[model samples]
Target: MAKLTKKQKEAHAKIDKSKSYDLAAASSLVKEITNVKFDASVDIAIRLGVDPRKANQMVRGVVTLPHGTGKDVKVLALVTPDKEAEAKEAGADYVGLDEYLQKIKNGWTDVDVIITLPSVMGKLGPLGRILGPRGLMPNPKTGTVTMDVAKAVQEVKAGKIDFKVDKTGIVHAAIGKVSFDAEKIAENAKEILQTVIKLKPTTAKGTYLRSIHISSTMSPAVIVDVKTV
Candidate 1:
């Protein structure tokens, strides 16, 4: 195999892209981190048919990352009367009732993710329906339903983003950036693929995965050879 060039070595070192500084020496670091220049998270988003730019919904679900997501995520909970403390103890950022629904209605649309309990579903289900059409509903079949309050909070805080196959039979989500270490993003990608595989609907026919394309948060999409993933 050919030896990696000095430029390549320097590029690999830029994988630790902390926002503190955009080191001039690391100009090619993002490209070097991997043989690609796309956002792994955004790439994952595209494969699932999610047009991040125009996505009007927030399809919620969960997946246990065998290799773990490389980034941190904020977690929020929507609980009823008795579940507030449980949600807090579980490390939820904010726990409340239906009142907070307005936040979603208003312009506080930074809900990167959410998870809810089953008992509260009946009450919140319809509310979630509003977000569902916008791809913001938290459905269990997509890994959104859970009775475990702590699990929901922890996964979100730990960067466990949720994505569900849309009506078109595809799921999209952000895993990480291509500027991220290939190994890191690749690991997360594997975890996501495995989860999607498990979510395969027994009722469906033909190819389980129509296709998968990887890209950056602001870049063109690239098809990955994930025949094994």
Candidate 2:
């Protein structure tokens, strides 16, 4: 195993492995432990009790963070000419159809989110291989594929994000940057937790939220008490 750096060791020292902290305490502690010079992204990982291998147990949904993700999201709007103005007015970084599609086909996915009209989905089917793996593929369930291009683009720009439970039954999402206040981080974390709770599958028998942890990039994970959250 690689030896921990001085900062890494100090961060780990602050966390008590045997104890689970309340949401608010964990949020505050995460900020204190992060020693990176740059504004590192704060992330939360929730381990659920569902078996993701079973179709009925799959969990996936979207939530708009109370405090917008500190990162300025870049959005690419692929729409017909008529809807181009609407998309642009809604704050889409890149707006167009054929040209953007051609660029994507040429392996250029430089944007954070992609919003497109329902009619344009068919054309995007062929590029699924490229976007799917990158988690950039627009899906109707997440409100990315729709006729109201402006609404979709605006929502994404305003901190909307989608998350899905992985095969290992863990849902990981970036909540905010370390630069945000602890209260802001707690609020964002609560928003995601509540949304996931509401999406609990009926087939999920045992404990719904198995474990929750919050941390910043390169910082030790802070265990959060699910009971308190």
Candidate 3:
């Protein structure tokens, strides 16, 4: 095993492995333990008791963080000429139909989020192999496929994010940056937790939220008490 650095050792010593902290305490501890040169992203990982393989137990939804995510989200609006101006006005980083589509066909998906109209989804069907795995495929359920391309682009830029449970039954997401105040981090975490709770599949049995952890890039994970959240 690799030896821990002085900073890593100090961070590890501050966390009690045997204890689970409340949401607020965990949120504060996350910032304290973060030791990185760059402004690291504050991430939350929640393990849920659900069989993701079962269609009925699939958990996926969208939530807008109370305070915007500290990172500047890159948005790609794949729309026709009629909606090009509106998409650009709404701050989409890339707005075009054919050129962007051609780029995507050539294995280029450089944007974070993709928003397109329902009418345009048919054209994207053939590119599913490239986009689906990256979670960049626009879906109506996630509000990424809609006639209001501008609204979707604006929402994404404003911190609206969609999350889905992975095959391991863990939903991981970045809540904010370490530079954000502890309260802001807590708020963003709470918002996502509440949204996840609301989306609990009726087919799921046992404890829905099995465990929760908060951490930053390269920081030790802080355990959070699910009940207190």
Candidate 4:
């Protein structure tokens, strides 16, 4: 092995001590340059440095999770008799019909994700306010309102990742962990970067992607080279 420089030695040492993808190296970088005291989230967030005052720069979108939610996201699909079998074939935990709308309304909190055929939203009434804040409402723009029940269930089971810009115009999502091989994690990270790159709004001026960083669930984000990305 080539002799390690002091900086490289320190960087690797931080990651080694972190056990999981705590993103220690990224935190070390912030401490080194900014001298800002921070925990993992703040440490990772500072790198975004996106001006929150400007709403247009925010990055937000949704992606089908490849590994399903780390937690079982019980999927419920609202469909007609014609579509029930397809929904079942697609792995819906519960295949509901228009009639069950009342039953679901009575027991709304029990559901995790809701998939509705194009016709079901009418029955939802004003409950969107209740579901919207929790991000449970199925909106057409996000590809939630559709008749394709099987695909919806499969995507949910595979850990569909969601990215939304925070107050600082930063988008973050959980891809996996350091326990995963470096190549796999890097690949997942790259996919996220690519998604964000494509999501850059044409209306937004200035640099669409101000910067790109990768961080594990509890780690600091390290600024990755976007040019190579």
> What total of clashing residue pairs does each candidate reach?
16, 0, 0, 10
lDDT of 3 by residue, 80-125 (tens): 9999999999999999998989999999989999999999999999
- Order of quality (TM-score): 3, 2, 4, 1
lDDT string, candidate 4, 52-161, tens digits? 56666566677753433245578778888888999889888888675567665665656677888888788775676677777677766555678777887778777665
lDDT for 201 in candidate 1 is 50
lDDT head-to-head 1 vs 3, winner: 3
Give lDDT tens digits, candidate 2, residues 1-229: 9999998999999998999999889989999999999999999999999999999999999999999889899999999999999999999999999998999999999999998888999999999999999999999999999999999988998899999999999999999999999999999999999999999999999899999999999999999999998
| TM-score for each predicted model, relative to the true structure | 0.63, 0.98, 0.99, 0.66
Model 2 RMSD to the real structure? 0.7
Q: Can you list the residue pairs that collide in candidate 3?
A: none
**Candidate 4 global CA lDDT score:** 0.60
- Report residue 104 deviation for candidate 2 (angstroms): 0.9
Comparing 2 with 4 on TM-score, the higher-scoring candidate is 2
Least well predicted 10-residue stretch by lDDT in candidate 1: 19-28
Q: What value does the lDDT take at residue 122 in candidate 3?
A: 94
